[model samples]
Target: MSNQHAKPPITTTNAGAPASSDEYSLTVGPGGPNLLQDTYLNEKLAHFVRERIPDRVYHVKGGGAFGYFEVTADVSQWTKAAFLNNVGKRTPLFLRFSIVAADEGAPDTDRDVRGVAIKFYTEEGNYDIVGNNTPIFFVRDPMKFPDFIHSQLRLPDTGMRSNNMQWDFWSLTPESAHQVTYLMGDRGTPRTWRHMNGYASSTYMWVNAAGERFWVKYHFKAEQGVQNFNDAEAKAMFVEDLDYHRRDLWNAIARKDYPAWRLEMQIMPFEDAANYRFNPFDLTKVWPHKDYPLIPIGRMVLDRNPDNFFAQVTQVAFEVSNFVPGIGPSPDRMVLGRLFAYGDSARYRNGPNYAQLPINRPINEVHNYNRDGPMRFHHSGNQPVYAPNSYGGPRADPQRYGDPSWFVEAAEIMRTANVAHKDDNDFIQPGTLYREVMSPTDRDHLVSNIVGHMSQGVESFIQERAVKSYWSPVDADLGARVAKGLGLTITA
Candidate 1:
């Protein structure tokens, strides 16, 4: 409604000066040549040349819209986060959905994990929850992240994605079994961003007002319920519309059919990590619901679409380290590494002033001393820019907003497993999923899909490794079915 009657003024340059004509670029004597003397023409050309910043390293193709997150339940017992302090309190938010392994022009129907990057503009500051649609990740260690992504991307020489390469990396890395099984199953190709749930696969620590700490994971359950396309249906939709998810989201919001999701949290006491059967900080595994149950907290509704795709959606940044007073990072290795990596990558791709951008900026008045980067918008007035001054300047107050404290045991500096981890192996959870969770139809689909994807294009050697090493470890039935489907012999 704000833009309902906005034909008030003509377009202008970045400077407030009104433009004389947008139809024609200034030229010397009617199309002789572009005139360098024409400031507007030169400015336009220069800005156009540098319109785009570097795309994201993983979540390159993304789209999002403006929305609000409203607390619907009391959660003060587990978290002291102000955003979740009161029921019926509304916080402005933006949720950007993207594919993990995709080019700018890649189809929406590709079988890839979708990013669910959310930013909450609370009174405290900007808090970001960077996650994927799946509950777990391909690998737990950040050391393997770059190499894993390289395998998913195009070959160095031909610049074409090789199935062999992807399977090879995943096969050798046994920890990827749970997430790999989920990805190769029906859940991989979601019908739309609206249909799939978003999960914080990494562990986080939240402290209450009473100073009690709890390890937590976030789950945003889609109100529309889970929906997915079969491999054939996904391929057909890709051929029909490359921008299927993008158009679906925009049109749905425009038609007043706003999409919504319920926010849920799984909380575990700080001391419970010591007794858990598996590594509580492992990125490739999920906390079982039977142990840590989901508590309904809030609801998120996307009610409006971004007016400019490049401005709002493309330029937006999400950092794993973006936390408020109560929420903080955990001992998760992947999470620890991303705390620095995401912010650094965002700065390199979007410039040092990316946080100052409209979509990424916090609603709270930024009171830090950080100033004078390229395209710096606001310069603090009269106040002393540096600390240790006689003049009034914001000083650090550890009691008011300092990060929460957690006990850490001293260990030797070396590559090691999770603390108190029981039998550090990968396939147990995936085997549980195959045996106890999925139904007969789901199991059939999983086997057929793996065989179809692997045998169709992957090299014989790669396929053999994938079947015997990855699939078999997860479940013998799954491996045998895949081998039979692929017309390959299964041996002891």
Candidate 2:
């Protein structure tokens, strides 16, 4: 083909072999049968056939961007992390926002939980702050997580999600009260991903260079201000545009109306966990800001949009287990459970070499003995695959690169309650949120949302049980109001 505007080279196959006309397939004769001898056509069809990969079981639909995290304040006294060692330092990061408990096909405007997964490619390593829009989650224990998520999904026989199953599970599990309140309130239908704050609300451990350990929590407060839509408004908006949230994010970054968040934290001494008013590691609970006030450290800004949406947003993996120096896991059951689950799920969905993918590859050098798996792109040249080799293999440094270690009593192995959690009741935080935290108008909206969900296709007995077991525990007045609105009798 002759062209005035000269390109670098002619079209080629995936293997760099010069390609011919891709319009037609090779055949035995004109319109007889396709020939396997056409390697170019075969390669194209095979690649296209296996193009799609398995999506996340949760947080399947998402929007992502590349950006930078700037250290605005210093916290070197608390953490030995190199990224947080100095003020005015910047770290490259990729952030992904997604809707929970839904497939990729679902609408972005669905009234569901949103996830904020940010991967910080710091010099130390890739640290993923996998969090959610809400400060707390529904289930405290990892054992209840799968069952809780199952209720929100399709039923075995009918294959349709039932409100009865969802409410029934929540009513039975009292620990879910706090998150349920957040979910049914106006916050559930956030205006857009840019408007909701992100949280490392789960407790984590931070150890300084001096071998001092402290419990910490992170909050990314949205600079754009938190906003939400009422039920009426959300329904109307969904009808007009189902991908409203995704479009809002892509357009916002494209127009340079960049969104930003302040990264703040709550720090408590390691020994303080024993006598804290609440279980500090509970995922269903929040550390009161009054008791543990926020301390600003850094800020995150998303200024660039991804050129390839599928590569950056869909394939980018953020595991809960990815931790770097100066940071380590806690006794939080949910976090512990996810440490295994997140990595395992990613391997299955993205293949074993998923980490080697460009979107997931760390900018810093990655040297490991892990070798010989499917799709392995990098094999260190002529290096011993095992450790303890005389050929200059990388080795762990206990003194230089060690993580902080804390002692847990031998008797703490079982599920039995200790003195700290003996009287740890689930109703405390949700009640405080209802009675003292929310405004009068906010309470009204919360009640309205609860009634609307409970009133849908659920049996009268389950409805009554849900109100009495869940809502009544939060506030008797709220339970009574919900009963009245649902036209149900309030017995006992």
Candidate 3:
């Protein structure tokens, strides 16, 4: 085992100068009046009135709460992350739930994909899981993200959203079958944020204490149990309460009816991924439970609501790039893209010192070269900022701390599709979802939802293409039923 105390005692300040007893403010001898001669006084006062930065673009309408994630089962063999090392360990966390594509004033009952983001304040650093309410996503590649969101947003000519635009994009992109199926089903309109499961939809890499790696996916099953509204009920909810989900979450916590979720992981041995039945990293697919069953590791309960909505809820940021030791990203293209997009979004919304925000700040002390932004507060007194200088400064300690990364093949860079594995067809799992997973009542609701949404102003050509090319490939009956609902004939 590597030595935890590999680095020598901190002999220099973060600014790279000799350390000193600067913990106290300069004052007149013992109990005399304080003097301005102490330059430390000025520095202390400045940090006291620390300025705040501006904040957001997406997940606009949301609610969140403070919670603690308690490890239920020991997972030390799967990950070396300190928070997951010991059973009964409780790590403070903040979870935010949101409705994607909805504006700040939009009704929470709208049928849309829900965003689930969790930030774990671990001993090492902040580990974030920025995911969605569903296990699969609409597109595998990040290149199609903006286009997909645009299709869901309001049209340019008239500031009103069009279902035709959505169906057109989904029909053109066949890879979206699985997530589209989930969306057009009863799951789309969750009864409340507390009644839906959350998934870290992208595959990730986890390293054990032995340095062995594995491919992993995260699922947070709502202990409240999954509940949702059918198409008509969801529509009626809009008229009943615009903020139904948000209100329910707040009131539940306030009344001591805490919402909880059980954390489960589907882990695949690292070497198995190369020859897996399908691309394990595909955002549009799921690794069947039969192959790698879920291992329940922890339980998260949201027992405390945020005091201020704007500061703790709206301003709270979750960067997908935030990874603690023993856990890192995978080859999933969407995950790779998000590693940059999410953090950059935070910097743009909240200034470069966004991480310094109270909600985003880690529980442990942060010592790094990151300095001098809009609302800069902390300054390493008298220490040089740069590293590798004669002046002592914090340096990388790979021997003591493992990098949250894996060995990558040095392949030639080029734009192409992800490598395909056996049984990699996009429609396979969604077809299984329709045929096997969904109950008879669930299937009826799915078909009805699809028909209800697609029948609204979709072009005849798009309707035919969706039924024949998209839904039919997923399942013949599904395609035919959707077509029958649209009063259209399926080709081929």
Candidate 4:
């Protein structure tokens, strides 16, 4: 065994001056009001006042830790990504778990999608895998994302969340049935951040050295094992500790009981995607594991908690567009939307120099003509900012890294509805899931849970719409059972 833990000596300000004292703030007249003339006091107070930055619009409540990703199995045949090119390769990483659609003060145990963002500091660059716990999402198209979020958020008039508005959007968007079923189930309420599984629901592209592209989906199976709270249990946990999930994660790491997850990937050949039964790139669907078996790629263990929560967790940005040379995005519409939205939101919240932050900065050397933004920290070293200049500066190197090229067949370009497949009838998968995937006890609990939440809304029509959507997906009997539990009759 090796002892890799050694603390660095404490230093003073940016000028590298040694500090005599750090404990007491400089004050006037022995506990009188602090003097404005004190440089250290002014620096500390001014920074403290502005320490808090803007909160993220989504995934506001988050927890993070330092970790390493160790490759367990070879995946070089599928992807030319250097991080996963060989077995036994370990890359430093940071993991952030967050609650989607919640305020910073919101309870961690709320019934919301959990975000799992992994920043892999690779030799190529920082590669980020941003995903949720569920394998599917509510909307397939990116254009509908804003509308969907608006519907799920607080009502414009009342400034309160409305179940009616949520159901109204879900009922109208039939494509949301698959993800909605998973969200309504017990898995929606994870016990803690450590116990939940993370998934890359969107299909991505992995190109090998030979220039062969493969569609890939990522899964992080929790080594702690999946554990969820029932509706009652989740509510109780919230009241007891609003930061239950965050606390659990912090305590686990503090005790040296590091939590881990196995990285698994489902890969499909490029040609198969075009002729596949379902649209492989759809966000609202899942690739059957039977057809595309999960291949073990790596393992990630979170070992160290952040020393400064705000610096490491709150300001840390993960963007889908932050891809290295080999790993790239697929044509998944939702992913295409996110590649733009995530980076744009980070720029808005943290400024254009968000990438310069320590937590988000890449371990590899960065050279580009990107100069002069808000809070520009780096000096380009007298090198000409413009390319093809007389002075030596970073020049475009195509041989070192070639651009990604994937085959795209002829298709009409228009803002029409999604192309429906022969198997595109929305209800079949959710129906099978309800009948086959769930056990008898699980089915009973599912019905009970649905009825409990549905009973709270005031609008009768909205309730009817909700019931109909559920019934249409599963059997009529299951729907009737929920209706009976809610003291309502189902009509033909």
TM-score of each: 0.95, 0.96, 0.88, 0.91
lDDT of each: 0.88, 0.87, 0.88, 0.84
What digit string (tens of lDDT, one per residue) describes model 2 on residues 247-321?
A: 998899999999999999999999998878778888888888888899988999999989888888988988888
Query: How many clashing residue pairs are found in candidate 4?
Result: 0
Q: Residue 360 of candidate 4: its Cα lDDT?
A: 91
Model 4 per-residue lDDT at 324: 88
If candidate 2 were superposed on the true structure by all CA atoms, what would the RMSD be? 2.3
Q: Model 4's lDDT to the true fold?
A: 0.84
Off by over 4 Å in 1: 1-11, 16-20, 25-31
Highest TM-score: give the candidate number: 2
Task: Give the per-residue lDDT of model 1 (tens digit) for 138-235.
Answer: 88889899999999999999999888888889888999989988888889999999999999889999988888899999999999999998888989
Looking at candidate 1, the ten consecutive residues that score lowest on lDDT are 416-425
Cα lDDT, model 3, residue 408? 76
List residue ranges in candidate 2 displaced over 4 A: 1-9, 417-419
